[model samples]
Target: MKKDLVKIIEDALKTLGIEKPTHIEIEIPQNESFGDMATPVAMILAATLKKPPKKIAEELVNAIKDKSVFEKIDIAGPGFINFTFSKKYIYSEIKKLMKDKSKFLREDIGKGKRVQIEFISANPTGPLHLGHGRGAATGAALSNLLEAAGYKVDREYYINDAGKQVRILGLSVFARYQQLLGRDYPFPEEGYRGGYIEEIARVLIKEEGEKYLKRAFDEVSDFFTDYSYKRMLSSIDSDLKDFGIAFDTWQSEKELYKKGDVEKALDDLKNRGLIYEKDGAAWFKSTAFGDDKDRVIIKQDGEYTYFTSDIAYHRQKVEKKYDEIIDIWGADHHGYITRVKAVIEAIGYPKEKLKILLVQMVTLLRGRKPVQMSKRAGKFITLREVIDEVGTDTTKFIFLTRRPDSHLEFDLEAAKAQSSENPVFYVQYANARINSIFAHAREKGIDTDMLYNADLKLLSVHEELRIIRKLLTYPMIFEGAVNAHEPHRITFYLQELSGMFHPYYNKYRVITEKSEQSRARLALCEAIRIVLQDGLEILGISIPEKM
Candidate 1:
């Protein structure tokens, strides 16, 4: 629709003896009364053509005819051209939607490029908290959006299995095991103290018995560290699965280290003069590539830092030949983005190929009161608890309601609400209501097959035209969501689309009088329902047949 409008304007300019401008902006008007779409092309071309804005707009509008798609064009609000489409043209689009509903909503903007999005790489030291859940939902929705835009997407979770954090987790479990056996032990101050550590300790006690616990403190800690890391990772995986997030790959940091990729990446950096020896340690010259300062790759103890393993992991991703790599990290890691991109650039890869998306924290709220979460103090809300309180669909939808970069204040009552106040329920209700139209049609013995073949020209009602206009915007919405790599746009689009449908439903009758026009309206209702279902499916939300 936007393309057709642009071509019409371009043709009008050529006829008016005006050269095409460099660019033009077309956007939906904030005030629906303005028109369906408003363009500032004439205002932009005024300076180039040496004419006043209004003069240019008037001439352009006169040159453009309302022959095909456009019903009329008017210049309003400081030389902005507002476009209103003919009801017949919109009804034709609705027919197109019904004939090919599945493919109508998708755009080929990605051109089948391979993209890998790594997200929710939470450390295996503890269960996933609410923050991790937000990242998981965002990443999953992003992958679905990219695929819907015709890109091959790979979802991944990078596990920090080999780190000081895992060591602390192991020691925490060992201390709990000793306490469970009624032995005196002092747990390290820096170790994990979450209640989940006791669960891991119980599993260790059940599997290996007292003989394993009788070993020296250091030896048992080493054994428990390896066992507990795997156990915690498995538990995290299961929890995410319950939340409807499944990763195509679970790349382990420890596996990368064992494969010697970390050392190899460091050597490659050294060969490229990107690494240097400093203070008996190795550091990468990250500052040269726009980082705040050089980053340490190897410490004085001859152990690689987390940055070293991350460089290797990124290199491995590039070696896999992905057209783009998107890393979704928590907001606290925002400062780490520059260095990671610098490393990718230093490794002979384009910096644009690696995109780091930082997702802000989700602040859980009960009405106006904030719910505090702290991992170190063992005061936090687990993802499982959120999922249990609200179903996975509601949780995912609420998480995706806001942009990832914006902090979200999740209201528990709003999410679990069964009324129209909940955005998720409101959107699902639109689908249910559309299904009700079909049920009414069947009950009245009105055959819908005749409507599919009905002359779409019969659908010229103002309410029906409004629904068709909303449906026509799907492709543009999809393209924007894909280009921005933001799935929250789809959530917003779904809400707005549902709002348009509900009012239309209240104004018009789908099975009134059981005439041919009624059948046509019922067919339109079916098309709307299917498109809503498809949109909800992309967001991983269910369309309840009866809400």
Candidate 2:
């Protein structure tokens, strides 16, 4: 419908011999009384035409040939053209929605572009924390939105299994194991002291029965690292899966090092003259590609840095032929983006093809009180713990209520509440209410499946029209969220839609004896249900029919 109006405006500009702009801005008025849709194209053209905006608006309005679908077109304050939908058009759209809900679904704007998104690739040193949970939820939701917009999207998790962190994890577990055997071993001061590490030690003792206790630290470190890496990664995978996130690929940093991919990446950079020796270390000239300074790819000790592995992983993604790559990292990794992006440019890949989303920190709350967390103290909450305390749906929904770059305060009390204060509850309740309406209609022998025969014109009430208009905005919301890479926009849209629905449901009944009117309204309710279900599914939240 917006497309249709934009075309009409474009035709008016063309007929008037006025050059059309590259893009037209159409907006819905804040106060619906202004109109169903509004445009500022005439004002946008006023400066170029050297004419008063009001005069240009009037001229543009007069040039539009088909005003039958609009009840009226008027130039409002500041030369904005406001359009009100005629009753006939609204009824037609409602009937179309009833016949086929897909009409409201957005088009395939992506046009088969292949996109690879790697997210929540936390090191398998410990269980996933709240920060990892946010990345997982946001990445999963963004992937779904892109798929809905017709992109061939592949989700991935990059494992940092072959790093110093894993070595520390091995040392931590080894210390715990020695303590279990009553042998004194000083744990590294910076070693991981999480309770989960102790659990791993206990399991290893049970399986091997102190067989590795007498082995030298160097000999047992590899075994402990490999054993703990696999177990911790398995735990991370299980938590993510239970949270409704599944990755298409699990790329291992260990595999990259084993295959010499990191060295290959460095050699490629050296060939391009992007690699330089600085202070006995190999550095990449990242500053030439907008980084603040050159970044060291290898230390003086002949060890590859984490950045070296990351660059290689990104190069691998490019070689895989994905049209676009998206990396979701924690806020602490913000400085890494410029250097990684520089690597892409140094490799002659289009910098625009790679995008990074930095997920900010999450502050958990109980009511209004902040939940304290410390990684070193082993007091931080795990993602699995949050999911266990509150169901997966609640966790996912709350995680996305804020933009990826914004600080999120997820209140436990609000998430568990059953009122409108809780968005998941509110939205799900609306869906459940719609289902109950359909059930009542069914019990009363009202055939909801045959709503096609009902007269949709009976839905002329203001609230009904408002809902119909709101439903028409689904595709717009979908497109906006996908293009902006913000799934929280959909959550906001669903919340507003629920705000509209609860009022309508309370004021009017959908199971009246007026069979045709009831059927039309029931069809409308079902349309709302379909849209709610679609939006919730994109956010990876389930719809409970009886919630």
Candidate 3:
């Protein structure tokens, strides 16, 4: 419907020999008396065309070729044009929606473009924290939204397996294992001190049983490192899967070093003159591509920095022929973005081809007070613990209620409430109410499915029309979320749509279907259910028929 109106406006501009603006902004007026849709295209053109906005608006209105569908067209304050559709036209459009909803639901904006997103690739040294869970939720939902918008999206997890942290993890577990075997070995000062370390040590004792116990620590370091990290990575994968997320690929940083990708990437940069030797260390000229300073890729000790492997991994991702790449990282990695983007430009890809989103910190709350529970596993709470306390659905929904870059205060008690204060509960209760209405209609011997094809003209009340108009805004919400790469927008819409529904259901009684008016209103309720189910599913949430 917006496209149809924009076409009419464009035709008028063409007929009057006036240049059209690049974009025509159309919105639903807050004041229902103004019109169904309002635009300021004339005022926009007035600034560029050097004419009075009122005069331009009148000229465009006079030249309009078709006004048959409009009840009236009026120029309001400061050259804003308002359009009110005729009743016949509005009903005809709703009828079209009933018969062909796919046409009204979404457009194929991506046109077969491929997108690759890597997120929540937590270090294998420890358990996943709440921040990682937030990234997982955001990435999964964003992937769904892009796919719904017709983009082929692949999700990935990049493992930071080749790092000092894993070495620390190995030493941490080795000390615990020695202590369990009655040997006195000093633990690393910066080692992981969690109870899970003891668990891993016990597992090793049950398997190896003192076979490698007498060997030097140096001889068994690699075995301990590989075993500990793989165990933690398995735990991370299980938690994510239980939380309703699964990645298409698991990329290993260790593989990059083994395959000589780091050397290949450095050689490519050296040929481009972006690699320079400075003070006995090899430095990357990142400033040539907008980084604030050059960075050292290799130390004087002949060891590669973390940045070297990062560059190689991203280069491999680009070589996969994806149209775009998205990386989600913790907010602490903010400074790394510029250098990584510089690497993209240095490798002949545009900086815009790579996008990064940051996940901020999360604070847990119980009721109105703060939650400060310590697990024996880690100092901070684990994502698994949260999911265990609250159900998976509550945990996921609360995680997505804020933007990726915004700090979130998740209240475990509030999320589990059955009251209106709980956003998920409020929205899902409306879905349950709708289903209950259908069930009642069926009990009265009314064919509930037939209501889907009911005459929408019977829905003439103001509240009914308002609900219909709100329903029409869903596709707009979906498109906006896809463009902004924010899944929280869907949560906001869910609250607003449910707020509209509960009040309407309270004031009106359905299943009085002796009159077709009741059937029409019941059909409107079904339409609301359709949208709620779709929105929740796209966010990887389940719908409850009863709550």
The numbered model that scores best in TM-score is 2
Worst 10 residues of 1 by lDDT: 413-422
Count of backbone clashes for each model?
0, 0, 0
**Model 1: how far residue 109 lies from native, Å:** 0.7
Q: List ranges where model 3 is wrong by over 4 Å.
A: 365-377, 413-420
lDDT of each candidate versus the true structure: 0.85, 0.88, 0.85
lDDT at 158, model 3: 95
Candidate 2 lDDT score at position 242: 93
- Candidate 2 residue-wise lDDT, 65-97, digit = tens: 988999999899999999988878877776666
Indicate the TM-score of model 1: 0.95
Candidate RMSDs in Å, in order, are: 2.1, 1.6, 2.4
lDDT of 1 by residue, 1-547 (tens): 7777888888888888788877667888888777888999878887777888899899988888655787777889888999988776777777777888767778887789999999999999988988899999999989988988889999999999897889888888888888898888887798888888898888778888887655666766667888898998899989988987888999999999899988888889989999889999989999988998999988999988988899999999998999989999999998898999998899998899999899997888866688877788677789998889877887888888888899888777767764346778888988988787788777888787745577666677777777778888888888888899888888998999898888888877777874778877877787778778878878877778986
lDDT of predicted model 1:
0.85
Tens-digit per-residue lDDT, 1-547, candidate 3: 6878889999999998987888888877888888888899999999889999989999989998779989899999999999988777776666565555655666577778999999999999888877788888889999988888889999999999997888889988989999899888887778888878889989999998987675677899999999999988998899998989989999999999999998899999999999999899999999998899999999999888999999999889888989989998888899999999999999999989899989897888788788775533357778898888777777778877888888888876776663345678788888999999888887887766766578778888777787777777777777778889888888888888899998888887876745687788887888788778778977888799997
Global lDDT of model 2: 0.88
Clashing pairs in 1: none
Candidate 1 wrong stretches, greater than 4 Å: 16-19, 220-222, 417-420
